[model samples]
Target: MKALILVGGFGTRLRPLTLSVPKPLVDFANKPMILHQIEALKDVGVTEVVLAINYQPEVKASHSQISILQLRLCLLKKASFYFLQVMLNFLKEFETKLGIKITCSQETEPLGTAGPLALARDQLIDGSGDPFFVLNSDVISEYPFEELIQFHKSHGGEGTIMVTKVDEPSKYGVVVMEEETGKVERFVEKPKMFVGNKINAGIYLLNPSVLDRIQLRPTSIEKEVFPQIAADQRLFAMVLPGFWMDIGQPRDYITGLRLYLTSLRKKSPSKLSTGSHIVGNVLVHESAVIGEGCLLGPDVAIGPGCVVECGVRLSRCTVMRGVRIKKHACISNSIIGWHSTVGQWARVENMTILGEDVHVCDEIYSNGGVVLPHKEIKSSILKPEIVM
Candidate 1:
C-alpha cells in the first residue's frame, strides 16, 4: 500500500519552534511528529510513503571546480536552504531506517490540499487499482490504518474520510453521513446552523479515480472535491475509534500530548514512567536524567538528554531534547524547547512556550509567554504574550 502526507509549507501556526526546525521534524513525545504517521503506515504494510511538500530548497547553481571554502560561504549565505537541505537529509535517513520507499512530491507553488493528489497521481496509481491514504501532517491519533483500509474496501467508494465527533461542530466542516450505511450525504463547512457533530479527521483513503476530480491547480479536497464526491454518492465516512487532535498550534499540541499519554497508559502502562516522584502518566527518555526530590507529570514527556535538578516540579509539559532545569524550578502547562535552560527557582506555567536555546534567569516567572529562539528572559511575564 501507499500513503501520501500533505506536509504543506512552513508551519506558521507553530512558530518559533517551526522557525528553527521543520514542523514534521519537530519532536513530539520524544520523536519527530511525522515519524508517528510514517511508523503507523509502515506497521500497516505501507511500502511507499510520499510527502507532498510545498517548499523546495533553492540552492544556487554550483560553478564547476569551485573550492570547498566557496561552497561553505554559499551555504552560510543561504542559511534557510542549508536548513532545508539538512531536513531532507534526515528524511533520507528515515527511508533507510524504516526500510520504506519515501518520495518527495515538491510543488512549484502553494497547491492547496487537493492539487497535490493530482500532481502525485502517477506515484499513487501503480496499476494495482489499490487505494492510497492521504493525511494532513499535523493530526495525531491512534491511526487505525488497517481498520480504515478494511472499511474503505468494504464500501467500494471513491473516497472514505475518517471522521471524529467534536463538541463544537460550527467551528469545523461537519460530515453528514448515513448512520447505517456510512455514506456521506454532504459536507457543511463551519455551518451557521446546527449540523452533525462529526467532522473530518484529516485522514482519507481514496481510490485512484478520485484524482480525476481534482485539477492540477490550487484546490481544496474538503471544500471542493469532497462535496462533488458526496453529491455523487461515492463518499463515505468512518468514525475514528480513538482520540484525535490537530496539533498545529501550541495549545492543541499540549492537549494532544495529554490525550496521547492517557491512551498510552491504557494500552501500554509499562511504557509510562513510575516512581515516587512521578505523579501521573509521564514519559522520560532513557537518556533523560531526573533528579531526586522532584515531582513530575500528571502528563509530561521529557525528551532525550534532558536534565532536571532536585526540588523541581513539572506538570503537563514537554521538555525537549538537551534541556536543563535547575533546582527549585516549577514548570507546568508549558513546552520547553530544545536545549533551553531554566535557572534555579524559576516558575513557568500556562502554556508558556520557550523556543530553542532560550534561557530563563533565576527566580524568573513566566506565564503564557511564547519566547522565540535564542533569547534570554531576565524578568517575569505576568500575562500571555509573545516574546520575540
Candidate 2:
C-alpha cells in the first residue's frame, strides 16, 4: 500500500534548529526524524511514499532514487561555495538509500492537513478504492501497522484512526469509542476538563471514500473532517499496543531521544555500553569515545563520533554526534547537539539544550535556556538568553 507523510509545517516551536533544517530532518538518536517513520512504514509493506514538502525541496530530492544516484558533487576552494558544493555532492551520493519510489508534492501556499490530501487526491487513489495509510512526520512510534490494517478490514469501517490512551486528556483530542463494536462514539478536541483517556495518536488508516468529502481548501482532519464523518457513524477507532511519542515540543523531543536510546540498549546490550568508569543505564554508540578516568551514566547517551575528554563527568545527559567534551568539564541533564564543543571546566545543567556547532567556553554556566545553533557562550557568569 501507499503512504502519505505530511512535512510542510513551519515548525515554529523548534526554532534555531528548524531555522536551518525542516522539523522532519531534525536528528533524534543520531538519525533523521522522518527516516524512522519511513523505516516503520516500509516494515508494514508500504511500497510508495509521497512527501508533502514546502521549505526544503532538496531534502526530498536527495532521498529520491533518481536524485540519489545521478546528483553530482562539485568542490571549489572558496569557503562560501565549498559548503554549497559539499551539500550538492551528498544529495547526489545518497540517493536510493531506500528503494521506495518517492514523490514530493510541493505546496505553493500553506495547505492544511486535509488540504494536502485534496491536492494529492488523484495520485493517492485508484479505481479499486484501496485504503491508504497517512502518518504525521513529527511523531515516532512502533505501532503495529499490519495489525492496524487488519483491524480496519475486519470492521469494514469508512475510516479507522489508530488511538492510544494518554494520561493527560486535556493535551489531545480524546476519542470515545464503543466498548463492544469498536466504533468511534465522538471526539472532543482538548477539552478543558477530562472526558476520556484515549487520545488521537497521529496515525490513520483512511478510506478513499473519505477523500471525496474533503474540499480543496485549508482544512484540518481533526477539526474539520473527522468530526463530521463521526456524525454519520462511519469512523472507527483501533487501539495501538506500542510506544508513541509526538516530538512537537522541546521536552518531548528530548524524551523521545531517551526512549529510542533506551530501547536500543535493551535489544542489544553489548551495543550500547563499553569501557570502564561508565556506569548505570547508558547508550554509547559504536563510534563514540569515552576518555580514561571519565565518569558517565545513570541515564546517559553518547551519540556516534562523540569524544569525552579525561576526568569529564556526565550524568543524565545526551551528547549528540561529533561533540567534543574537554577535560574536567561537568555536564548533567542536558542535550548537546552535533559538532558542539564544551571547553574544560564548563558546567551545563538544568535542562540546557546546546544546538549544533555551539561552543561553551571554559568555566561557563548555562541553565534553563536554549543555545541556538552556531552560537558561542564564553562568559563565566550565567546568562538567561530567551529566544524570541
**Candidate of highest lDDT:** 1
User: What tens-digit string does per-residue lDDT give for candidate 1 at 207-271?
Assistant: 98899899999898999999999999999999999899999999999999999999999999998
lDDT, residue 90, candidate 2: 37
Give all candidates' CA lDDT scores: 0.91, 0.75
Task: Write one digit per residue (lDDT tens) for candidate 2, span 1-388.
Answer: 7788887554667655664555666677667677787777778877777777542222224335544323431111132233334333433332366666666675655568888888888778866677988888888867578898898998887888988888888987799889777798898888898777998888899999989889988788988789888888999988877577888766777677666656666665676675678676677778887788898876787888999999999987778789999999998877788899999988988777777888988888777558888888877435545433
Clash tally, candidates in order? 0, 1
lDDT of 1 at 142: 96
Candidate 2 ranges with C-alpha deviation above 4 Å: 54-95, 126-128, 265-270, 274-280, 381-383
Instruction: At residue 152, give the lDDT of candidate 1.
Output: 93
Q: What is the TM-score of each candidate against the true structure?
A: 0.93, 0.84
Candidate 1: worst 10 consecutive residues by lDDT? Answer: 53-62
* Model 1 residue 48 lDDT score: 96
Q: Residue 211 deviation, candidate 1, in Å?
A: 1.2
What does candidate 2 score on TM? 0.84
Query: Cα lDDT for residue 300, model 1?
Result: 96
RMSD of 1: 4.8
